[model samples]
Target: MGEDADVATSLADSVSEEIADRLAPVDAELARRYPGEPPTRQPVHTVYVPADAVSSGTVSAWGEQAREMLDEHAPDAVSFASVLGLPSHLAGPVHDRVRAKLEREPVEDLRIDFEDGYGRRPDSEEDAAAARAARLVADAFEDGSAPPCMGIRMKCMEADVRDRGIRTLDIFLTGLVDAGGLPGGLVLTLPKVSHPEQVAAMARLCGEFETARGLPEGRIGFEIQIETTQSILGPDGRATVALMIDAAGGRATSLHYGTFDYSAACGVSAEYQAMDHPVADHAKAVMQAAAAGTGVRLSDGSTNIVPSGRREQVHDAWRHHHALVRRSLARAYYQGWDMHPGHLPTRYAAVYAFYREGMERAAARLAAYTGNAGGDAAVMDEPATARALSNYLLRGLDCGALSSGEVARHSGLTRADLDALAGRATEAQVNSGP
Candidate 1:
C-alpha cells in the first residue's frame, strides 16, 4: 500500500510540471496585458478648465469659490449632512474633512481643456495659448502650487482637426521640454476617440515626441476619451474599447467618459442626458469591464448643472450634484470630472461621506482576514476580498477621507502592511517583511 501511494505522488508531481511548462506563454501574456492596479494615488476627481480661462490662480480661485459656497449654503455639519442625506455619525467627520481638503488640496487633478471647451481659434492664437498653458503649468509645478496631476486635453483626431490637434500637442510638449522638463504629474487627454487606429496614432505621436524631446521612451501617457458609440463597439460587432487599449501600446493611462457628447451621439434629448441615465450606465459598464485589470483607470463623466443664482437654486444644484457623485462612487467609479467651481463642495462631500461611512467595516474585515486581530470575522473573506479591503482603506487614506492614525488604530496595520497585502509592495519590500 505504501509503495502504491509513493508512485501516485510521483506521477502527480510530473503532471504538474508538464502543465506549468505548457502554460508558460499564457502566464507571460497575462502579465503583459493585465499588470494589476498601479500603486500610485489616483485623484478622486478631475477639474476641467478652459485653456483660455486657466490662469496661474485658477486652482486656488476654484477652491475659494467652493469654500464660499459651503459657507453660504451648508455652513455647519448638520446642515451639510441634511442636504446630502448623510447619516448623523458621518456628518461631522465628512464635513470637516471636506473643508480641510478644499483648503489644502481642493483639486487633486486639473485638466486645461483645449478641445470642446476652447473651441476653434486661429493657428497663431491657438499656438500662443498652448505655449502659455505649458508655461503656467510648469511655473505652478515649480512653485509647488500645481495640483497633483495637471495637463491638457487636445482636440480629437478627426480629419478636419487632425493637423491642428497635432500642432497643439507638439507645441505644448515642446514648450514643456524647453521650460526645464515635463512635470512628474503631466497628463494628456485625446478627446472624441472613435477608433483603435486613432489610439494607435496617438501612441505613435507620443513616441515620436519622446524621441524628439529626449525623454524616456514611454514617459508620456494620455487618457482615452470614450465619447462616441463607435468607441464602445465596432461595426464588426466586438468591443472596440479593449482593442483601443491594446492599440495604445502601453501609453493609455485612463479612459474618461464624455457625458453630454456621448448622450447626444446616442440621440438622447438634451434634457434626458445625464450621468445616471440607462445609456450612460451601459457605456460605463463596458468601460469598467474593459479597464478592470489593465492598470488603466476609469473616470466618470460630469454634470453640466452648475450651482448659481438664488440661494434656493444653489442649494438645489448642490443636492443634485451630491447625489450624482454618490451614485458614481457606489458604482466604483472613484474618479470623475468636475466642470464648475461650485461642484467642488458637493464633490468632496460625497467622496468623504462614502469613504468614512464604510471605513470601519472595511478595516475590521481586513484586520480579521490578515490575522492581525483576534476572533474570526462574521463573513469569511478570501485573498481577493482582503486585497479589496486593503485597497479601500488605502484609497481612503490617499484622498484624505480617513486619517492614517485612525486606519492604523482600527486595522492594526500600518501603511506598509496595507501596501503589502494590496499587492503594491515591491519584491524587496515584501521580502523584508514588517
Candidate 2:
C-alpha cells in the first residue's frame, strides 16, 4: 500500500529466492536418496518360532506356555521377576501385571520360519513341512487365532541356498492359496541380504507370485534382514540398507536386525555377540538413520539368552534379556524377535516398564508444550516434538501398554485433538527418534 513497504517486500522476496536457489541441490539429494515419511503400525516384537512347532492355535498355545512359565518362576506373583530391576518389595505386583498382559496378549507378530530356526532338512521332509506350515497358517487365519500380524521367514538367495529357499516358498504359497486366500498384514522376511541384486530378485519374485495367485499387485511386501556387514555398508561406500530397499521396487515394508550374524560379520567373537554391544549400536543407528521417517519399520535383534529350567541360571539370564530389550527400546527400536516362548515374560516386562517409567514425564512435557489451558507453554513444541508425541502415544496404544483413556487424560487432549496430531504425523517428515 505504501512506497517504502512495497520496496521492502520486493527486496525480501528476491533475497529469499536467491537463498532457496543455492539450497536446491541439497534438497534434491535428500529427496532422491531417502524415503519420504510414511505412517506405520510397528509391532512391539515378532515371535520367531520353528515351522515344525507352529500350529493354527499357536497363540493360545503360547499363552498357556507363558502361564506355565509364570507358575514355575513367579508363582502367586510373590516370586515374580524379570530384568525390569524392580525392587524386591514391588516385584510381585509388577510381575502379576505383566503376566496378565502376556496371557491375554501374547505375541504381536509371528514368523513361521524356514530359515535359521529350521535348519536344512531333506527335500521330502522340507517340502512336507512347508505344506503343513501353510495349512496351519491358513487355519489360524480362519479361526482368527493368528496374532495381529503373521508371516514367513524364507531362506536367503545365496547360491548355495537359493534353490531350496524358492522351492519351499513355492510349496508353502501354493498350499496356503489352496487352503484359503492370502490374509492381509502378511510379510515375507528375506534374511542375510548383502547385495541389492538379491533384494531386486526377491522383489521380482514377489511380483510373479502375486500375479500367479491373482492377488492385487504389490499386495505382498517383504522385510530385509541386515545380517551382514555388507548390508550396513556395501562395496560402493554408501549405506547398503538404502540400496536394498530401493531394490525392493517399492515393496519394502520393514528392516530387521540380526544381532549375532551382524556381530559375527563385524568380526566380534561368538560369546560377545550380544544385542547392545557398541558395535551392534552402530549397526542399529545406521538402520534408524537410513530408514527414519520413511515408514520402513526398524526392529532390533533378539537377545538369545532364553532362560533355562535351572533356578540359578534364570535370574542372570532374565536380567540380561531385560537390559537388552530396554536398550533397544531406548534406541527407538520398538520391535525385536522373541526366539522362545520362555522369553515372553521378559520381553513384555521390559516393554511395560519402559512405557510406565516415562509415561507421566512424557505426558507432562507434551501437555506443557501444547499450551492447552493447564499447560505451562514455557517450552514451545516444534514439529518434531509434536510428531514424537503422536508416535509415543500411538506406540503405547498399539502395544496395549496405555489405554485410550489413559493417554487422553495424561496428554490433556480429547480424542479429536489426538486424531489431528496423528494426521499431522502422517503428512510430516521429521526424525522423531530419541
Report lDDT per candidate.
0.91, 0.78
Across residues 52-113, which tens digit of lDDT does each residue of candidate 2 receive?
87777778788788777767766654455433466665465457667777777787899999
In model 1, how large is the Cα lDDT of residue 69?
87
Give the winner by TM-score.
Answer: 1
Per-residue CA lDDT of model 1 for 95-178, tens digit only, reads 898899889999999999999999999999999999999999999999999999999999999999999999999999999999
Candidate 1 achieves a global lDDT of 0.91
Residue 24 in model 1: lDDT: 100
Tell me, what's the RMSD of every candidate? 2.9, 4.5
Clashing pairs in 1: none
Q: What is the TM-score of each candidate against the true structure?
A: 0.95, 0.87
- Model 1 alpha-carbon drift over 4 Å, by segment: 1-14, 374-376, 425-434
